[model samples]
Target: MAYKYSIGHLTYTFNDLKTLLARATPFRSGDALAGVAATTYQEHVAAQIALADVHLDVFLREALVPYEQDEVTRLIIDSHDAAAFKPIGHFTVGQFRDWLLSDACDTAVLKSLANGITPEMAAAVSKLMRNQELIAAAKKCEVLTSFRNTIGLSGRLSTRLQPNHPTDDPAGISASIIDGILYGSGDAVIGINPAGDSPANTRRLLEMIDNFRRQFAIPTQSCVLCHVTTTLDLIEKHAPVDLTFQSIAGTQSANASFGISLSLLEEAYQATLSLNRGTIGNNVMYFETGQGSALSANAHYGIDQQTCETRAYAVARKFNPLLVNSVVGFIGPEYLYNGKQIIRAALEDHFCAKLLGLPMGMDVCYTNHAEADQDDMDTLITLLGVSGCTFIMGVPGADDVMLNYQSTSFHDALYLRRTLGLRPAPEFEAWLVQQGIMDRQGNQLPDAGTYTRLLGGIGQ
Candidate 1:
């Protein structure tokens, strides 16, 4: 394209990620640093190609073929749980989808390396390798720094994202699709997604979070699930006084259970193995938040699955989760309707933080309403204000994303990146044009000045 954002600063968009990676260092053969995984190379590739709904071949042609396996092998390892280093029993569908969802090497290349790899598997594997140099290029959290002129950094940052779909490529494999995407240079993120069925997961994940050392852009998964006052107090105690927990959840999967009350769930969570607070090298996390899933007690939020889960997540982060998700329905400005109970539940977590992330942008209803677009955005702003959801996103598929960050979509399985944007769309062309995203010509970005002025100090 147009390369609009590249002319100056604020060029943080999905396209940039692809371009940067394309120009990034290439991987070398047999690089052990290419992220430790539970599955073998062959098994990993087979699963990547067989994932459901993924356009694997198309992704390979577009993003991978230009690079070599050695270049590709240097992938981001989302979690460093010992389980990741363990072996997989078989390439089942679940394993395949999970592996594919990761931003790692292609399944095709993985299969090619195996002795008895099949033709079908080879076709699926494609060419696989890590820009092994990329791994070395990354300056760990200790060294990652942020540039004042440009947003990309080498250390930690407040950046966040909410992706709309899974990448159809292996790059998606190494990166935790559904978790946080640590963008700025030396940085990492922390959050939970209710997937840890083990007691020690919190410990294991935190360790990995601390281990990702490199320079330049960094985005990775870091989480902790906690809800009850006691659990919160414990974390606080460990913090002010200093403490840490080493997770053994991956090793304690069988003990995880679905419960009915908050106390029971809390007990179950507390029961998980952990290092005493103050222990060093504890990075990856799966904190305790009263589970929001049906089997657990915290699921009363009003919206559908997306908001309900995200709402609880909001509380786990002490109420103002920097990033979150929501589900609202709209056609345009004059016609916006939301689920009230959901808003209440999410807002209830306001004490969570100074800023929170709302990976919102799901329309439960969409029709040809004239004022639908504006109504949707305005209402969304109002809802977010009340809900205290901070990090915003400008989703591409969003029928209504006035700007990128107040914010949100997703299916990549975890939270990742904060898309700072204010672009135009045409699904509701007439309505949006009236709102200023478009001009009389009905084409091209309105203008750099107009786009910036639109958010008007709401959130820069």
Candidate 2:
């Protein structure tokens, strides 16, 4: 079999794909396919397969996948894996063709096939889908995995207490966390990215979070965002570690930038699971990823940023992370360019990650140099809310005092809950009512004396 290939047009011979199609039951030239010939349809499917293979290949290396520049009407493919994603090898060309040509292809049945296929197949078929179509597929996905009811499930969004500080001071960190809690955030987990990567700093952060948990009886988990090795070290030292944290990338070299590998991540997963430190259960991993991290680390192989980002989610899924957030706009403008690009990338990341069977969230933010604003975040938050996003970053006043950037703030969490009629996780909501910040019916109360004292203590 002769095979042809191209870079400009990005074509591949796909002889195997052709053979796969030829062996499938022939499609009668009926009204379903209309005038589409069997051989022609075979070539079309083969071309799509080839394209997806090439696209995923590039995505694996470059950490970015470019959409076709020319305007084209795309098919709206759905993902079926409501609970979890199935491997791509489970389906054959015949099943894919049948779903692609079906009249009722827009429903859950086809969407399952769309998501159940391998990343390569999904990438290929996704080329035929519009952005809105992708979002629709994600909406049908319902992931219920959670530690202390932080993530998974639908109708509720969660928030992480990113209480990072310049000096890794316990007081500063606790103050930030207290503020987040006072504003009705941090139901997701009290996860922190420490200023220093040393085990001492990591241990101090973990101990602070644990102390606060004991002091306030906050029903949540904790993690210090450091290398998996550093976290493992802290775990060995008997530092309170609720969740193991790591920054994962799509490719080997990029992941190596943080000195991580698939084996190492698995080791961390096993080590954390052995701790049994979770308030809810033993799913104790928290991973953070961004679209440009691979490229920044000089690890991208010309793959598109979105694909690279999704590949990172594959790593996260391997460990069943309690929380996996794509810090979308936090990586800056070099990869995504501006707010328009950021919004598209944010939705694309959420849609792809969710379909891949990982609990997904967006850190709806942008660096100072990026072309974005709070209103841009507002747009993204609303979209993610409707799409059933797992959670969002909740800092103080949309600004990470330690990180020196603006992101979705605790106030934004309230806006999303009030506007979308979404509530916090069940345990967090109950905590709110107990503190008199909200009623049992989920209404905000006018007078909450604890809130006043909290504000006075924080001097806000």
Candidate 3:
């Protein structure tokens, strides 16, 4: 169907829902590259105005991707809870935005609405919201998940201790992990991005991290961010698999580009569940998604990057993942060209995922080739902190030798925790205090030498 809006002597028309969404998206390079972005600022605003009047029910009827061709669309349609949507079912996209920012949409209310709010609905309302509105609405939604430790509790911000090495060297990775733990990071999980995808190498990395976690008796889980299939094989081999990891996208075709399918992911989830690795809870999946992943694979089907990214959260939500993050700027300048665009994308990703009741976090990062720097990261991290983000990455020195990107560092986590008075996961915090690494007030104790004994045989 066609949609149009008029401004005095000027009129703008969108050919379809996909075109309306694409033109309404905040300016980004990927949309332009795909030849879907609006050609002028006026046209973009007009599209937004038209989109604001779209009723929430329209999305349920006209999917951007055909339901017959896409399993993702099928999953979304089949799982929707019509009863849960009754209260807000009459709202238009703009009215939904108003309701989200209103006092009526408290934590409990948003939690109750999660199953009813589709990802497309979330994305639509987000387009009509500003940065602070995005943060304000998301702040009201609390999504807590657990494994060996709990995450997403109020007054807490978790960090993934990412000790990535270019060669997957055990010593180098061990050193990074030690640095992260002492600095009050790693409450989310100690996850590593291996240099190779071979099953043997992936198994070795998982076993090494598992051993380190066990040796310290740290109240945290460990993961080697390998392909889901490789992790499944390792689980079969009885390697200590804490979380099954995968990079997923919005569309089935995009996921296929990464060598995954819904069925394959379901298989991995069931396989990992059999291990019963968690003492606290059994949320065993860790998923990483980013904007432009679908477009990068030529599979977005003309939807805007932000909407496609939001759709990926539906996939994460189905798995009940322990951790789900958007590596916001890691795809580089082609998708999110600069700091401004990257920051907006991160905020939108967080807000949409939270609305859908996913435990949303962000990898506040950028590539050197992109027009961004640490100052941009600092701005984003501060915003996410106040927005009640579940976790962030803790790479040593904010640089990943393996992935060759600039991410938040162990020190960055310390800065945010100190600035915002946030603590790590309760269980991890207790371990930190017991080991003399941190005080009850979330401050790092200045006695580095006292914790050297805890390193034991690591990095040897």
Best by TM-score: 3
* Segments of candidate 3 deviating more than 4 angstroms: 448-450
TM match of model 2 to true structure: 0.77
Q: Which ten residues in a row have the lowest lDDT in candidate 1?
A: 246-255
For model 1, the stretches where C-alpha displacement exceeds 4 angstroms are: 1-170, 173-221, 224-379, 382-460
Please report how far candidate 1 places residue 107 from its true position, in Å: 53
Tens-place lDDT digits, model 1, residues 1-460: 1111221342322132122221211221111122211123333343232332233223222322122421111111111122322332244323433453355534333323222221112222221222121121111101111111111122112222322222212122123321222111111222322233243443433333333311111222333332333334444334211111111110011112221232333443343224332122222222222112311222221112221232233222221122233223321212122333223222322211111211222222233432234344444334442222322332323332221222233211112222212111112223335445444343334355533443232121
Model 3 Cα lDDT, one tens digit per residue, 1-460: 9999999988898999989999999999999999899999999999999999999999999999999999899989999999999899999999999999998779999999999999999999999999999989888889999999999998899999999999998888888888888898899999999999899998888888887778778999999898888888888889889999999999999999999999999999999888898999999999999999999999999999999999999999899999999999999899999999999999999999999999999999999999999999999999999999999999999999999999999999989999999899999999999989999988888775745775674643
Candidate number that wins on lDDT, 2 or 3: 3
Report the poorest 10 consecutive residues by lDDT, candidate 3. Answer: 451-460
Q: Per-residue CA lDDT of candidate 2, range 32-88, in tens? A: 122222255545554544443342222222212222320000101122242433433
lDDT of each: 0.25, 0.66, 0.93
